[model samples]
Target: MKPLLAWHQSLWQQVLASWQQDHLAHALLLCGPQGMGKAQFARNLAETILCETGQACGKCKACNLFKAETHPDLLQVEIGEKSKIITVDQIRNFIQYCTLTSSYGGYQIAILNPAEAMNNNAANSLLKLLEEPPAKTLIMLISHQPMALNATIRSRCQRLDFSRPDKKLTLAWLQNQLSSTQDAQLLLNLSAQAPLAALSLAQDIKKRGELFQSLNQLVTKKEDPIEIAQQWNKHNPKQILEWMNSWIMDMIRYSLTANSNSINNKDSIKTLQNFAKQFDLQALFKLLDLQTEAYRLITAQTNIKAQGLLETIAIAWHKN
Candidate 1:
């Protein structure tokens, strides 16, 4: 069995304590920022409950079945490859699966990741199941943006918040994971202190640096906004928007307080300070709003032209 993550240790203890006291809830909502390993936590919990030893012993028959992805009592629901939203039919099937007896005579488990991806019909269908859960069953809803989920749905499940860990804990953990301590700090900053996300950002570090340089060129009027937009569109526009948002936020913070600590992009402090000096608060806010809207549209899967959207934001930045 995989060892539980250090940051997840507290939440895991809470779960284990609840299970030991027979006070575990029928449904749990794992809500937090993305890349916090909530899905892994849910799976570990499920495996523990299903195992003969009441722990996720890898040698057990149930554990072996789970490892092989053939566990009859475990169901994972997510959006389809060709689709953006989890449909009502999928939820209905999950509910049906829940009603059956556990094949191993253990707890039946279902995990719905990014539960907010469910449309109205699907969400409402899930509500019914939440209202009347099956015996000896557990339902876990994983959401990065819990507010986007139905209020009624949110209220029903016990919430387990997986926020970012302390910076020291994260930095120490990251340093152990990566070769360079300097890279670890930068990755942690880039990922907003989410360790798992920072690890994933390692490969993209160079790309992020290049993008920052491009933005710096745009700020200095050394690059064309249109051409920069084209280049950005060739990569992940959504991620670019996120990076832009972060930088803009940092600029605003530094402008208002003149505090280096307020800046998340500490490595680019000088450039961001220069950016803050050029734009007034209102201009920065406007640009931030534009990036925010573009990000929202992309995440909503709206039929917006990526290049056009990026171009507009880029031009706005250039004009400011």
Candidate 2:
């Protein structure tokens, strides 16, 4: 496996130690927020376990097959492009894969990312496999929201929690990755301190700035709700709503405490302050509630009418 991120070194050591001691769990749940690199870590562990040398030696047959994405012993199950849920069929196939011996006489590995994306039947099918895991098999379940998974499923696996990392180390690492100077702290705050998420936001600064500008125009009555909604709906609706949600939260924080430091969007502090002056606290709270509901609705149903929901949010902003 390639070297893990610095923050993951300690956990990697712990997991590697377990493997060396022959005490590694057959199933592991890697739980953390999105963009913390849990998926990458799980993949690395899988490679290590599957390699004949018990290390991810790039020259080894197993490593070569894994790098080519054709390793018979490695199975990765996730939601399909057209579907939000991992179906029972996928789980059934995974179970079948687990039942077989490894072709390389090494560990058979299965990685299920965003494990909560499994529907009830699919999860139940997986639960059965967990209940009677085959020997020399390892199942790595990566979850951004582990609480959404069934308690039984969670309990069945040994968990590797990746919830926290030292902020100073993360910021230093993020700064090194950028070619130009950037407000690493602001990006970190925007991403709830998830380093990879912060990096993604930093890379897309222009798009985020445009979204903030559009939101500002809506607040100033310079843009029509329907028109803005139409434009935003052309992009990712969920991301647009998430930005709006954060803005509303900032407005609320500034309104209550009059502290600019409390705001996540440091670049938009002045605009948020102006917005706070114009909109009442009640209206901001209502907008927040609406955004939360919109997020839930959009996430629950792929066919949801996001334009309508965005329009509703825009109208509310105009009204307030």
Candidate 3:
């Protein structure tokens, strides 16, 4: 298996130590933001527990099985391909799987990724499994939003937080992963400082630049909000909203601090500063509120029209 990221290594060692002492929790909730390597950590932990030497020794039969993706004692649960939520039936299946004996005569492991994707019924079903966990079984619940889970479910498991890593460490690691010259700091900023996410955003940096141009045109009243909204409707609503949020927040930041270094959109510092000067703090905050609401509505997959939402936000920028 691949090694854990540098930020994850310390936590890996802590869990390893716990497992070595045979004191690892039966159900562990790996809580963190997306792209923090929580899923990888859970898989590594499962492999370690299942391996013969409890070290994830690749030469061992259990390790080989895991690598081959045929580990009988392991179960991975996630939302179905066509579905947004993990159904109760899926939770029940995993519960049944956990009840069986470990084929390797060792740990029986189940990994529920993005555990918040479980609907109420599915969460309730999983709660029963947590309440009376089977012997020598490990249930790993991975969640980007832990608070969205049932309180009782959260209370039952030991939670391991994978919060943001050290800035220097994260930047260094991210810089090395880039194939070309890209500002690791900027990528980090755009991704909320998540390294893997920063890396993923590298591909979209050019697209972001294009979007920023459109935003500037709208803010300067050089472009029609309706036309821009129609153009933006072709893109991913969530990502479009995220980029807009960042730009509007930078405007707010510049408006308050008047420090270019404090803003995320360093490439557009002059534009943000110029725009910030035109709007009072309250107007900027209102614009931010509109953008934030659009973001929330899109993320929640509400029935609201994306184009109209974008148009409203665009018009706010144009009118402000």
Candidate 4:
């Protein structure tokens, strides 16, 4: 497969030169948030290393091996379906791969996506491989939570941190994908700077509508908060709350700027306008803060009712 469509131009330029010169390191750690395509970047790096006749020309024998899934030098450490943990046994198998001669006499590469999924023994096993890595072997660890990994494992690799693009770029990117004008700022608010989350939200219009409807009712009607929370908890609270937060922010933006494009709801602009006229910016900000804290609080606990969380969110908004 081809590399991801969007390349960080500056980073790609630097990496491409190093690959061409055969000066790249044996281990690289790609750090970024969820859905930021760090794993894809790691895959691209692996393809480049395994490519024959200069790096990443993409049409050589080695590249063909990769495409055919017959490359002797390539291995991947992903989560086990039911276990959800990378085991030491798996790492031991990877160690065996390290000892093999490359089919093309080129470099060997392994991509370990979400390195945090490694259990304690699995991580220590990996450290052993890192200690005496094969001369032609490379390890790429893709991580969203670097802080959760062992310190020694981190020290051995060159870490690359990828950040989210700004709203203007994200909006344009979304607009291009959907072939429709988008509310970038609104999406950004919902996604915590992760554009993929925004794109997902936009695609599920019916779910988004129900989420928005519940949020508006929660804000406007004195409904049972417990029932609301349980409903979202049964489905997906992350996406539901995210969608709610977006509409709430749009309401605030409409109140302050009368900016028509800031709202994500094309069919429910009337509701946005009504909420905008009713709520002030400071109040909206506090409500956002409350909703955010509620999300954090819910995730931190176990066996908690969605209604309780919903009540808490309502209280936060009602007070503000």
Candidate 5:
């Protein structure tokens, strides 16, 4: 298995200790924010558990099978690209797989990534499995928002929280991954201190810059809302909304505190300051409420018309 991130070393050791003592939980919830690498941690743990030597020896048959994505004993369930929710059918299949004996006579592992993506019926199906877990099985649920899951599911699984890490260690690790010229602190701030998210921003600087430029143009009345909406529709709506939310929050912070240093988007401070002065406090609150609802709708439903939502949000920005 690939090694866990440096910040996760202690947690990994703890899990190993539990396993060695035969006290490992049948169901584990790896809870953390997005981009915190919880899924990778889960995968590493699974590999170690499934390895014949319990060390994830890269040359072992089990390790080869796992790397090839053909491990008979490992099943993964997640929302498909065309669908927003993990359906009951997928959970049912996982249950069937659990009924079988492990091919390698080791652990039968199932990873449900973004576990909250499972619909009510799917979650209920999985809950039954959790209630009466099979022998030598490990069910790992990787969740960005554990609160979105059923309380019963949350209660059944032992949690491995990845929320907080030593800031100095994280910053040091982040610095090594980024180029010397990049501002690690600024990237961290933009990503809310999620290292992987910060790295992604650094890697996609051009796209991020373009997005900020579009927002600046919108705020200055230099671009049409409908046109920007059309352009953004081709990209991932969730990411678009996230960036917009961050920018709006920064603008609001500048308005309330008159402290540009406190804002997340330092690169866009001047633009935010100029825009913040023209926005009404009540209107800003209304926009925030609208964006929250938009995020809810996008997350809860499949095949949403994000263009219309973006256009509406854009028009709201222009008018404010």
Candidate 6:
């Protein structure tokens, strides 16, 4: 809530220093994957920009209003089931706020989480503001895929990319998180090397355990791979994709180097170890791509059924 998290310090600094000086842009596009803390960073940036005395001074009056979730100058726009775009109506309302003199007499900030969610009309309306940005106004547009946005919209703003942290860094950060709560190895299993992602996974312990168990059973006892994948995918497509990814990576790692560092499935790696022995490089990468493609399709709007996903994994799992 204080606008700081272990995995995002570099991002904090980059935006801060740029704004602290005169070089910060009126509009910034924040690019990162889903649940990777881009929204958090945008909130922190908003707080930092509106801080009365200095960057992110938590004790300031404006900061207090923000923490209380009633800041007059800070605006957050997100998509809902109600309408697709930020909606032309929503953007018009926001423009009214942006054009007004800031109540804080500093930067008035608006954050559009997943700016790519905007439809063409909504985006074009925002383009007008970006083209003629108000004085002391800052806009932070958070996106998972910058390519989804209009190129003209992208061209008007500074771009910042949030990348996945390395494994060692992720572990250290996880340890820090574990000190305060019950989020332990579960996040590591869910996110791989992304801290915020792992943290997100900690919220649902039972589902995670079930997903892990299903995959473990598939590897350990040689169940019907398609049936198992279908059952798991029916529960959560994303979880199935992530676990399948970790599954193939383990196979690839074990096949290539016999290294077990990447395998979170200590119970299942023995099975992978054996699979690695029978499978060669071509076979392994082919299996890897199978799951990788499934994950990509699942992440997109592809309408493949769970059985379809299962069959793909089954074929790839036994690829020769």
* The best candidate in terms of TM-score: 2
On TM-score, the stronger of 1 and 2 is: 2
Better of 3 and 6 by TM-score: 3
Candidate 5: the clashing residue pairs are none
Poorly placed runs, candidate 1 (over 4 Å) = 164-167, 181-183
What's model 6's overall lDDT? 0.74
Give the least accurate 10-residue stretch of model 5, judged by summed lDDT: 203-212
Off by over 4 Å in 4: 1-4, 55-58, 81-83, 164-171, 218-230, 241-320
Off by over 4 Å in 2: none
Better of 1 and 3 by lDDT: 1
Top-lDDT candidate index: 2
Q: Over the stretch 162-272, how does candidate 1's per-residue lDDT look in tens digits?
A: 875666777788888887635788777778678888888887777788899988888888999999999999898888888889999999999999998898887889889
lDDT tens digits, residue span 1-320, model 4 = 46453534456667778767877777888886675667767777778777775565768887787788777778988876545567778778877887777767777888887788787888888898888888888888888889989999999888777665544666666667764465655655555566676677667766777766766766676556566666667666656666667777778778777888777655678888887766678778877887787676555444545566666775554343
Count of residue pairs whose backbone atoms collide, per candidate: 0, 0, 0, 2, 0, 0
Evaluate model 3: give its lDDT: 0.86
Q: Is candidate 2 or candidate 5 better by lDDT?
A: 2
What's the CA error at residue 108 for candidate 3, in Å?
1.3
For candidate 6, lDDT tens digit of each residue in 181-274? 5645656655645677766666655675676566555545556766776676666776766766776778787766768766666656666676
Task: Note the residue pairs that clash in candidate 6.
Answer: none
Better of 1 and 5 by TM-score: 5
- Backbone clash pairs for candidate 2 read none
> What's the residue-level lDDT of 138 in candidate 1?
94
What TM-score does candidate 1 reach? 0.93
lDDT at residue 19 of model 4 (Cα atoms) = 67
| Per-candidate RMSD, Å | 1.8, 1.4, 2.3, 5.4, 1.6, 4.8
